[model samples]
Target: MATPGVFLISAFVFAFAAANIGGALSYTRPPPRQTLSVPLADDLDSNSPQQVHVSLVGEDKMRISWITEDRAPAIVEYGTSPGVYGSSAMGNTSSYKFITYKSGKIHDVVIGPLNPNTVYYYRCSLDSSRAFSFKTPPAQLPIKFAITADLGQSGWTNSTLQHIAASNYDVLLLPGDLSYADLLQPQWDSFGRLLEPLASQRPWMVTQGNHEIEKIPVIHPHAFTSYNARWHMPFEESVSDSNLYYSFDVASVHVVMLGSYTDFDPQSAQYAWLQADLGKVNRSRTPWLVVLIHAPWYNSNTAHQGEAESDNMRKLHGRVDL
Candidate 1:
């Protein structure tokens, strides 16, 4: 016969064993198989100039853009020296820090106040291997320009860019979604290289698109953050301190950019600034007026949902939207 203390100890040991066995059985089940996605770059390319395109800004201004995989600050070198006018335009450099982008900002450097009826030369670089050269539009009056939106770098999209180039427009006004950054970086890199031909020749005036917004935090560096760093737009020329929302005057046009992401009240800073800017514009200098913003005021789809916040803004333009 066992002593009382021994019996108690034996009973405790049995209970512990039972619990352990039960716990083990519960945890042995297999987990679900929903795998995470991986970025799709099996091969890496060298840091070379890609997506080179040109846009006509004004009579004296042009925008040049390119991309590199260097993951470093971008640099540009050119001057009026012999063998150097096609890429000429000594300006401050802009860096690309957004990882969300496979490439960097489109280096929309301005080569402007250029001599009328003159050609210029220039080169773009990352560090070891990002060198590219291109020419400028001939200075002339009644200059022609191409304008559009939703341009991309792949899938026979070259045809669209080719059409723009063939027009030989002095300027290109792209209001939204220049290249789809929402796709992976490779797509953006392709778009970068695709535009080189057009960007090198004319000034491409641009705004932003909904696709440009950054949803992830890690990619903030590349998120339209690169946009701010790369393009030297004359946003400051507008009453607003930001080019993301500002206005500039071309020969006979007053162009304004609105921050469609936020609520816009006539009393808002940008609204007040627009009022002042428009008030100041001499109708004689710029007779035409146009507004550029990402969101549409009204559309039929609504995508068809109802929300008070969206409804308030819809009142500005319309309830239905694009």
Candidate 2:
């Protein structure tokens, strides 16, 4: 016969031994945790025009956006004197912003009055040889430009962009759906790094696309938080900075950027604001009026099949006659 206290102690010792054995076995073989990396890549090759593009941000002003393959300081050398570009030159150093967990820096350089239609030589680089140039289009001239969406593509998609680029144009406007973000962090980083060329040379203006919508997985939150966060668009005060929606004067044209993802319905603040904005366009000063929205209301593409909300807003602004 054993004392109750002694028996209790013996039982406790046995349990402790069993627990230690279990712990040892578990330590020897345990499940692994999956780790992820924020994606960023070597920018486009140093000074090479990876995604060279241009946009007329305003009268006498051309915005150029491009990419480099490396993380280096930016150097844009330009001048009205063609052969004397590097000499008697107007030099402006620029910067590239790499978003959190994303790769590559977004670079912008604005040049102006460009002799209207004269051939102006220019070059852009950072940390090295970003040599490039182009002739600015003449002012008050009817210009042809390419428009597309779902860019920031890889090699295959890049081929498509190249196809579009083959056509000469005064400006390039990308409405949205740039990266085709599929919840992979590295893909996002690579996308930014790759587009440096086009973004740098051209204005490469854009709106938040469907891919810009944030999500935890393939499901559907369809939120624009990620897009809004990464971009430094003027959506508040300076024309188009506060919310990716604003008005700007481009030569004789009045351009309006609308925020379809946000509230643009009659009851929303954006709707009222836009009505007020369009009301004041002063058609006399700006002859041609244009509207840019991520999701166009009337498109044959099934992806935009039922964009009823955007359709409604577009109808409200029928002045464009769509």
RMSD list, candidates in order: 22.6, 22.7
TM-score of each: 0.62, 0.60
lDDT of 1 at 277: 76
- Model 1: residues >4 Å from true position, as ranges? 1-48, 53-82, 85-112, 125-141, 217-223, 230-232, 302-322
- Least accurate 10 contiguous residues by lDDT in model 1: 6-15
- Candidate 2 Cα deviation (angstroms), residue 196: 5.3
Whole-model Cα lDDT of every candidate shown, in order: 0.52, 0.52
Residue by residue across 1-322, what tens digits does model 2's lDDT show?
A: 1111100000001111221222222222223333222233355344454444555545565655554445533445666664445522222333322234443444555566566655555665532344555655545536555566666555556675677667765555666676766555455545655565454444455676656665555444446654554443434433433455666654455666666567667897777777777778766666677677776554454543334434444444554464
Q: Which stretches of candidate 2 lie over 4 Å from their true place?
A: 1-55, 64-75, 81-105, 125-128, 152-159, 188-202, 215-243, 267-269, 298-322
TM-score of 1: 0.62
Candidate 2 root-mean-square deviation in Å: 22.7
